[model samples]
Each structure stands twice: as structure tokens, then as C-alpha cells.
Target: MLLSVNNITIAFKSKKVVENLSFSVDRGQSLGIVGESGSGKSATALAIMGLLPPTGRVTEGTIELDGTDLLTLLRNQENYRGRKIGMIFQEPMSSLNPLFTCGYQIKETVLQHQAVTARQAEAQLTSLLEEVQLTRQLGERYPHQLSGGQLQRMMIAIALAGNPDLLIADEPTTALDVTVQAAILELLNKLRRSRNMALIFISHDLSVVRQVSDHLVVMYRGRCVESSSVAEVFSHPRHPYTRGLLACRPRPHLRLLYLPTVKDYMEERPDGTIVEKMPDNPLLGATRGSYSPSQFDPLLKVENLTVSYQNQINVLHSVSFEVFPGETLGIVGESGSGKTTIARTIVGLLPLKSGKIYFQNYLLGKARPRSVTRQIQMIFQDPQGSLNPRMTIGEALMEPLHIHRLYSSRSERRQAVIDLLTKVGLEPDILSFYPYAFSGGQKQRISIARALIVRPSLVIADEAVSALDVSVQAQVLNLLKSLQQQFNLTYLFISHDLAVVKFMSDRILVMYRGKIEEQGIADQIYQQPQSEYTKQLIQSIPQYV
Candidate 1:
């Protein structure tokens, strides 16, 4: 084995995070560690690299790379990290230093490990960028200037600067779009083959892991519940958790119900013990109900809308669509394809350069005296940025109600805030907490509650669930569906995830370069896409059997 993790255990402030987990990776082999968030995947990676945070410690374990024990290394052991193992972190934006250019960062990494001058390191940095399939010019840009995929490639370049024997990638492609994700995976595969390097691929997405890993380890609550070859494990999984994971993946051959949650498989045994079973939640199971067309009139309509920035570069060009009273219209396209511009224009946050917007048949233009902000709301992609950090959850939730004068008394508004919290599956006690106290999923749920508290007929969710884990995303999607049924709400769902778009949308609209390439019913569009862009989108989604 090129790398071996023998009976490892990790803890955080006296609480055990991972327990007695063992796995191995051979030269040129990929071992995937699959689990949900907080399942100890990142912690395990940190322990192996000897880079755990101050609060965390590897209580018991031995990490061996090529016959040497990494855990036994001294605190200031020279050349330990760079010469043996390397890591690619989960968030590229945060992992990279904002002040440094890509080339400078990679050069620093090379110089840190090797006795090389600045000129020698620069030449190596250019070669590293080419190895990762990035353009040489990208090396001159800062981290902020690069896209998510480019940043990730730069991260790989830095990690491979020392040419370690093993590469540990923790959710490396999480923030990238699907097409970019596929490209990155392909690049990683090629690099592994060329260098004969062992890989530890960690991610929550099983479908993504299956594409690159030869060996698979399924983790639950910090325990390794299943470990086997990727083909054997995915083809015929013995563990219930593994089966549940496989069943949750959105497949092209099957119609999706609600995604399978971990809670779905747990059962009480006759001996008063709980046991988990496989195939408890089937992907092809019948859903609660098919979406019915709304009886009410259209809530929001855009007729030949055109929007441009101050530079006169057209962002949205003659886009036309209508969101009915209780329907979901999913707009899908790559980055910078005018998705956010449409959402911003509809909420009156952006100035429309041309075309008309109608809310309940009332025109929306700069000439209008009244603000339609209350009836049409927007939930942004990043909840942390959208929400005020200093304000309590209650204060943020009450802003819309206060602006519209929805309540006569403060007591009534307080009760409404509690009700909204409960409606979105949060406790009333969370009202006093700040946005930073909550997880990504919780923040999004809070954002949803805030958007709906005003009783808006329309809600624009722009990549709302992109950052969430699969199980949490499933719950949030379910909440949105149920809320729509109860409130008769209309949604303008804007996302690049085609599976999600197919799952939630009544109608689908494919956009490319600020133009609508195709528009049709969800089923027909997904099954038999007429446009080339739509067809490419359907083909790009990762497949699961």
C-alpha cells in the first residue's frame, strides 16, 4: 500500500468525531471517502496531514505513507508535509491567499519545499499550471479574478508543486458547475495516471466519487460502515447506508420521488435496538402528488425584458417569461448567463434598460411611483451576504413585515416571527441567534422563511440549494414543494443543476448567453430536448445506476 490509515480515531474537545476507521490506497489508486457533512471526512483528512486545528486532536491512529508513520513526526519536522503528502482543500476561495497572484502562490509552495530561487520556481509554476490544464495567463490573475474551477485548478497546482507521493482532495469540486466539475475530474484522473500517485478523494456526492475512485469507504456518524471495491460496492452494496446513498442519486432512467434521507432506513428491532436496512427509500417511488396548474392569474410576467450595466454591455437581452400563481419555472444556464440579472430586475433591485415587467398586470418601470418589493421577493445564492450579520434572526425576519405594516402590534409581529420559524422547521429560540450561529442549510431555511413571511405570491430562488449537502438539500426541496402546495406560491427557480430543475420545475427554460434557447414542459424537455444546448445539459449530468 502507498498509504495506510490504521485504526484511526479523532476527537474535538473530548468529543469523538471519528472512531476506529481504517483504509488503504495503493500507488496510482483512488480511494473515496463518502459521507454527509459533519461525518468526519474533513477531520480525518486533517489528521493524516498533521494539520488539525488547535481544538482537534488525533486521539489514536497511525498514518503510514510509504512505510513511514506521519503521526509520529515531530512538531517542527523539516520537509515532512511537502515531501510525503499534499492536500487540496474544500473551498478554493478561502484556501488561497487573496493578496497573492496564482503564480506567486505556486512559486512560494515550490520554494518552500525545494532549495530553488525565484526564477527557478516561476518556471516550475508555469509548468504546474499547464499540468492542471489551465492557461498560463491564468497564473497572472489573483484568486478573486478566477472562476471557481480556475481557482480549484490553481489549488491543485499548489498541492502538486512538491510532487508528493499521495494527494488528498477534500470535496475539491463542490463549488464548481457540472461541466467544469467533469473537466476537473478528468484532469485529476489523467494526472494520477501520469504521475502514478495514490489519491484520497473525499466528497459527499457518491455519484461524483464513483467516477474516479477504485476503492470506496462509506462513513456514517464517524464510523466506516462499508469498505469495498467501487464496482462491487456500487453494483451490489451490502450496507444499508451505502444502498440509501445510491438510491438518493437522481438518475435518468428513474422518476424521482423525495430523495432518501438517513432517517428513512432506521428501524426499531424486536430486541429494542435500532437497525438500518437497504433500499428503504426507493428513488422511483411515487411522489406525493403531481404539480397541478394554478387557478389564479399569473403573479409575475416579463415581456421582452432587456437589462444592461453602466458599461452598456447587455446582460439580459430580450428575455420573456411568465411565472404563474402556483407554478415553478426553472431557468438554467452556466455562469454569467443572465440568471441573476433576471432575478434582480424582477425584484426592482436592478434598472431595466428595456421591455416591461408586470406584477398582477401592473407595469414595473422607473416611471412607476409605487414599489412592488413586498409582493415579489428574492433569496440570493449566498445567505451570509444576503443576511445582516449583526441583526438577530427575528430582526431580519421582521424587516419585511415592518416595511409593509403587516402587523398592528409588536406582540403580534413577534408571534408571526415564531410562526415563520416553525413553518421553516426552525425553533422559536433561534430568533435571538445571529446568522453566523446557524449552518449553511439552516441559514437557507431562515432565508426562505424571511422571503415567505410577507405572503409574497412569487419567490425567486437563485441557486439557493447549491451549497447544501444532499440530505439537507432534499429536506429543503421538500419544504419548498410543501410550502408551494399550502400557500399556492409561484417560484422562479434559477439554477445550473439540471436534476434539481427537472425535479421542481413544472416548465423548463434553457438559457445561453442571455437568450432563451428552449422552453417546454419539464418531462418533454428532459426526455427529448430539441435544442442543442438543452441536450448538452441533459447529457452532462452525472449518471447513476
Candidate 2:
């Protein structure tokens, strides 16, 4: 084995994060460690690299690399990082330095690992970028200048600078669109095969992990519940946790009324044994719902909508669409494809170059009225970023009610807040807690509650569930659907995930490079995509087979 982790236990301070975890990878083989947040997959990766935080320690077992003890190297202050093992982190934007150019950063890594001159390192950096399928011109630009895929490629180029034997990818493609993700996965496999490198792929998405890894390890809370070949695991998942992970993700081929979560598949005893439960039939034939634009008056209309940044570059060009009163009009595209720009423009966050927006037949100008603001609320991609960290949930939810001046008394507003909390599957007791006290899923629920508190007729959800785990994403998507039905809410949903967009949208709009590529019924768009971009997006979706 190239790398072996035998009965390892990882802990931070007095608390155990990972217990009795065992896995191995041979040369030129890929091992996938799959789990959601707080499942200790990343902890195992960190332990192998000796990069754990100050409070964390390898409490038990052994980690061996090429028959050499990894802990011994750490204790002796010997460098195995970059020389023998390299890692690609989850978020490329945060992992890379923003101050320097991509070439400079990559060259610095090359110099640190290998004995090379400055000019030699620069030459090597260019070769690495080429190997990762990135252009040399992009290397001269800063991190922000690149797209999500480009940044990830740059990260891979840096990781490959050392020419390590083992590569650890920790959620490398989590933030990327389907097309970009497919490209990255292909590139990684190509590199691994050509270089004969052992790979440890870690991700929450089993479909993505299956594409890159030969073996699979399913984790829950801190234990390795199941380990087997990728094909075996997918064909016959033994653990309820594994089954839940497999079933939770939205599938392009299947339209489910409600995506099943981990909780729906199993109940965990206090002693930690799992009891499997029978899941309901969630399949919906053909489509979720049907809607034609001519059926009802348009709730929102955008005519010749054009938006530019600093009057030099046009981000949205002559975009036009109409949203019915009770249907979801999903906009699907990659980053910088003008998805969020449309949402932001309607919410009065950006200055349009030339356009006319009508909400309820009333023209919306640059500065919207208080009434318009109350009725057209937005849920952003990152819930934590949108919410105030210092403010309590009650204070955050009630701020909108206070601004709109709904309900006469403070007691009425409090009750309204409580009701909204309950509507979003949260408790009234959480009103006293701050945003930091909640998990990513809980924060997103709070964001949803805050958006719906004002009784918005039209809600713009921009990548709202993109960052959530598959199970949490299922819950959030179901909640959105239920809330929409109950409140008669109209959604202008925007996301890069096509399966999710297909599930939630009545009609779909495919966008590419600031232009509408295709727009039609949700089923038609998926089953019969006309444009090459749309077809590419659909084909890029990871297949179960």
C-alpha cells in the first residue's frame, strides 16, 4: 500500500472527531472518503498531512506512507508535505493568496519543493499550468480575475508543482458547475494515470466521488460505517447512512416530489446502532407541475434588460423574461453567465444600462418604494454572509416586520417571528441565539424565514442551497416547495445545478455568457436541449452507471 491509515482516531482537545477509521490506498489507485460536514473526512486528510489545528491530535492508530511512519516524520520535524504528499483544498478562493499573481504563487511552491532557479521555477510553472489545461496568460492575472474552474485549476497546478506521489483532493469540485466539475474530474484522472499517483478523494457527493475513486468509504458523525469498491457500494449500499447519501442528491433523470434525507432512511439509537426504515415512493412521473406563461398575467416582466459594470463590460445583455404569478422561472448557467445579475437588478442592487422592469404592472425605477422592497425579497447564496452575526434570530426576523411596520404591537411582531421560525422548521427557543450558534443548514433556514416574513409575493433564490449537504439540500428544497404552495409565492430561482433547477422550476431558462441560450418547459429543456451549451451541461451531469 502507498498509504495506510489503520484504526486511526482523531480528536480536538478532549472531544473525539474521528474514531477507529481505517482505509488504504495503493500506488496509482484512488480512495474516496465520503461524508457530510462534521463527519471527520477532512480530519483524516489533515492527520495524514500533519496539518491539524493546535487543539487537534492523532489520539490512536497509525498512518503510514510508503511503509514510513507519518507521525515519526512529524515528530522529527521532517517535511513530507509537498515532497511526498500534496493536497487540493475545498475552497480555491480562500486557499490561494489574493495579493499575488497565479504564476508567482505557483512558482514559489515549485521553488520550495524542488531545487530550481527563479527562471527555472517560472518555466516549470508554465508547464504545470499547461498540464492542468490552463492558459499561460491566465497565470499573469490575480486570483479574482479567474472563474471558479480556473481558480481550481490553478490550485491543482500548485499542488502538482512538487510532483508528489500522493494527491489529496478535499471537495475540489464542490463549488463548480456541472461542466466545470466534469472537466476537473477528467483532468485529475488524466494526471493521476499519467503520473502513476495515488489519490485520496474526499467529498460529500457520492456521485462525484464515484467518478474519481476506485474505492469508497462512507462516514457518519465520526465512524466509517461502510467501505467497499465504488461499484459495490453504489449497487448495494449496506448502511442506511450510505443509502441516504446515495438517495439524497437530486437526479436529472428522476423528478422527485420530495428528496429523501438521511433521517427518512434510518433512526440512530443512543448506543449508536442504526435502525433502517422503509422510504416512501418519491418519484414523480414526467414533471413536477405544468405551467404556461399565457395562463395568467405575468407577476414580473423584464424588457430589454441590459446591465454593465463600470460602463466598460456588459454582464447582462438584452435579457428579457416574464415570470407568472405562481410559477418558478429557473435560470440555469455557470458563473458570470448573468444569473445573479438578473436577481440583483430586480432587487434594485445594480444600475441597469437600459431596461424596464414592471412588478404588478407598476414600473420599478432605480430606487424601489418601501412597499416594493417588502414584496420582493431575495435569499442570497451564502446565508451566513447575508445575516448579521451580532443580531439574534428574533431581532433579524423582526427587523423586516419592523421596517414594513406590519402588526401594531411588539408582542404581535414577536408572535409573527415565532410563526415564521416554526414555518421554516426552526423552534421559537432559537430566537435568542446568534447566527454563529446555528449550522450552515440552520442559517439557511433562518435566511428563508427572514425572506418570507414580509410575505413577499416574489422570492428570488440565488444559489440558496448550493453550499448545503445533499440531505440538508433535500430538506431545504422541500421546504421551499411547501412554502411556495402554502403562501402562493412566485420564485425566480437561479442556480448552476441543473437537477435542482429541473426539480423546482415550472419553466426553465438556459443562460450562457450574458445571453439566454434556451427557454422552455422544464421537461422539454432537459429531455430535448437545442443549444450545444445546454446539451453540454446536461451531458456533464455525473451518471450513476
Candidate 3:
């Protein structure tokens, strides 16, 4: 085996984060380590890469690379880290250095391990960029100059600089769009086969892992619940955790009302261990009652909407759409495809270069009135960023109510906040706590509550559930549907995830380069996409099969 981890247990201070995990990968083979956050998949990768935090230490077992212990090599960082084991981290933007050019980083890495001359390293940098399907010109640009996919490709080039025996990709394609993700996976597989390198692919995404790995190791709460070949695991998963994960993925063809949660298949053992038993995967259908059948009454309208940065960089090009009451109008596109621009323009956050915006059949002036702001609420992509860190949950939610002067009485506002908190599946006690105290999913629920507290008719959810895990995403989606039913709220749901858009949207609009490629009912659009872009987007969805 090129890489062998034998019954490894990792700990930080008194707490054991990972326990008795074992896996092996031969040259040109890939092993997939998959689980939710805190399940020790990334911990195991860190243990192998010797990049764990200062407090984290491997307490048991041995990690061997071709019979040599990695623990011993950790003592000499220069000896094995860059030379033997290359790693691609989760976030490309953070993983790459912004100060230096992509070429400089790759060249430096090559020089560090191979002892190559400056000219030779430069040549090697060019070769690496080309190997990763990047142009030499792009290497000269800084990290910010490149797109997400480009930055990720640059990261892969850097990882391949020393031509390490094994590459550890930790959630490499998590942030990427479907097409970009497929390209990266293909590139990794190609490089792995060509270089004859072993791989440790760690991700929460099972379908992505299935595409790259031969062996699958399913983890739950720091334990490897099941380990087997990818084919076997997918076809005949014995563990309930694995089955739940398989069923949780939102399929392109199957429009599920709600995804199966991990709790459904799990029971607490007497000793505190989670006993996982396979459950029947039920296909539940959602009613379209929340969506208004009659689309004649439009709640919001955008006509010839054009957005640009400094009157130079054109973003949205004559973008026009109407959001009807009690219906979700989903805008589907990749990054920089002007999806959020429409949302921002509608919310009056961005000044349109030339456009007309009508809310409730009334034309919005140069700047939308405070009344419009109160009626049209927007939920951003990053829940944490949208919320104030210094402010408590109560303070945050109360700001909207306070701005509108709906409830002049503080006591009444507090009561409303408590009720809104309960509606979003959060308790009143949490109102005292800060945003940091909440998980990503919980923070999103808080954001939703903040949006709804004003009693807005139109809600622009801009990639709201993109960052959340599958089960949490399901919960949030269910909550959105239920709230929509109760409030009769009009929704402008924006996302790059086609499956999610299909599930939530009454009507789907495919956007590419600021232009609408196609627009139709969700079922018809997913089933019979007329545009090539839409067809490609649907096909790119990662399938468990």
C-alpha cells in the first residue's frame, strides 16, 4: 500500500475526536472518507498530512507511506510533507496565498523539494499549469484574478509540484458548481492515473467521492461504521448511516418533498453509541398549494435591468423577470452569472445602470422607500456574514421590527421575536446568545426569522441553503415551504444547484452570462430542457449510481 493508516486514534487534549480508523490505498487507487462535519473524516486526513492543530495529536496506531512512518517524518516537515504527500484543501481561496502569483507558488514548491534551478522551476511551473489545463498567462495573475475553478486548478498544480506519491483532496469540489466540479474530478482522476499516485478523497458529498474513489469508508461520530469497495457500499450499504446518506442526496429526476435525516435511522445505545439500522427510503410528494396557480398577479417586476461595476464591467444584461405572489421564481446560474445581481437590484441594495423595478404594481424611485425595504426582504448566501456578531439573536431579529416601527412597544416586539423564533424551530432562550453560538443551519433559521419578522410579501432567498449540509438543508427547505403556505409569501429563490431549484421552484429560469436561456415549469424544465446549457447543468448533477 502506498498509504496505510492502521487503527488510528486522534485526540486534542482529553477529547478523542477520531477513534480506531483504518484505511489503505495503493498507487493509482483512491480511498473515499465520507461523513458529516466532526465525524473525523477531515481529522484523519489531517493526521495523515501532519497538518492537525497544535493541540491535536495521534495517540495510537501507525500511519505508513511505503513502510515509512509519517509520524517520524512530521518531526522533519521539510522531509516528507511537501515531497511525499501533497494535499488539496477544501477552500481554494484560503488555501492559496493571495500575495504571490500562482506561478511563483508552484515554482517555489517545485524548487523546495526537487532542488531545481530557477529557470528549471519556471519551466516546471509552466508544465504544471498546462497539466492542470491552465494557461501560462493565468499563472502570472494573483489568486483573486482567477475564478473559483481556476484557483482550484492552481491549487492542484501546486499539489502536483513535487510529484508526491499520494495526494489528499479534502472537500476539493465542495464550493464548485456542477460542471466545474465534474471537470475537477475528471482532472484529479486523470492526474492520479497518469502520475500513478494514491489518493485519499475526503468529502461530505458521497456522489462526488464515488466518482473518484474505489474504496469507501463511511464514518459517524468519529467511528468508521462501514468500510468496503465503492460499488458494494452503494449497492448494499449495511450501515444505517450509509443508507441515510445515500437517500439524503437530492436527485435530479426525483423531486422529494423532504430529504431523509440521519436521526430517522439511528437509535441511542445504552452505552451512548448510535445504533444505525437501515430504514425504508420513502418517496414523499409535496403539494404545490403554496404556489399560486394563477400567475397573472405579479408581486414584483424587473424590466431591462442592467447592472455594471463603475460603468465598465457589465454584469446583468437587460435582465427582465416577474415574481408572482405565493410562487417561487427560481434563478439558476453559476458564479458571476448575474444571479445575485437581480436579487440585489430587487432589494434596492445595488443601483441599476438602466432598469425599471416595480413592487406591488408601484414604481420604485431612485432609491426604494423604507416601506419597500420592509415589504421586500432578502436572505444572503452566507448566514453568518448577514448577521451581526456583536448582536444577540433577539437584537438582530428586533432591528427589522424596530426599523419599520410596527410594534412601538418593546414588550410587544419582544413577544413577536419570541414567537418568530419558535416558528423557525429555535427557542426563546437562544435569543440571549450571539450568532457564533449557533450552527450554520441554526444561523440560517435565524436569518429566515429575521426576513419574515417584517411580514414581507416578497422574499429573495439568494443561495440561502447552498452552504448547509443535506439534512439541515432539508429542514430549512421544509420550514420555507411551511412558512410560505402560512404567510402566502412570494419567493425569488436563487441557486446554482439545479436539484434544489427544481425542488423549490414553481417556475425555473436558466441564466447564463446575464441572459435567460430558458424558463418553464420546474417539471417540464428538468425533464425537457431546451437550452444546451440547461441540459448540461442537469446532466452534471452527481448521481450515487
Per-candidate TM equals 0.93, 0.97, 0.96
Question: Model 2, 1-545: lDDT tens per residue?
Answer: 89999999999999999999999998899999999999999999999999999999999999999898798776653367987899999999999999999999999999999989999998998899899999899999999999999999999999999999999999999999999999999999999999999999999989899999999999999999999999999999999999888877887776567777888788999997889988754542223544555677899999999999999999999999999998999999999899999999999999899989999999999778899888999999999899998899999999999989999998999999998888889999998999999999999999999999999999999999999988899889989998998999999999999989988888899999999999998888999999999999999888766
Which ten contiguous residues of candidate 2 have the minimum total lDDT? 281-290
Query: What is the per-residue lDDT of model 1 for residues 1-545, given as tens digits with 9 covering 90 to 100?
Result: 88889999999999999999999998899999999898899999988888888999888878887888887875754466866688999999889999989889999999998888889998898899999988889999999999888999999999999888889999998877787888889899998999999899999988889888999999877889899998898788887767767766555444465666655665556763547754444543765345566677778879999989994899888999877877899998887778888998888788988899999999887654434667777888899989999999999999888888899988899999898789889999998999999998999999999999988888899999988877677778878887888788889999888888888888888888898988877887888999887888887787765
- Residue 212's C-alpha lDDT in candidate 1? 89
The lDDT of model 3 is 0.87
Best-to-worst lDDT order: 2, 3, 1
Best by TM-score: 2
List the candidate 1 regions with Cα displacement exceeding 4 Å.
76-78, 116-119, 252-257, 267-274, 277-284, 287-297, 367-371
By lDDT, the better pick of 2 and 3 is 2
Q: Pick the candidate with the highest lDDT.
A: 2
TM-score ranking from best candidate downward: 2, 3, 1
Backbone clashes, each candidate: 0, 0, 0
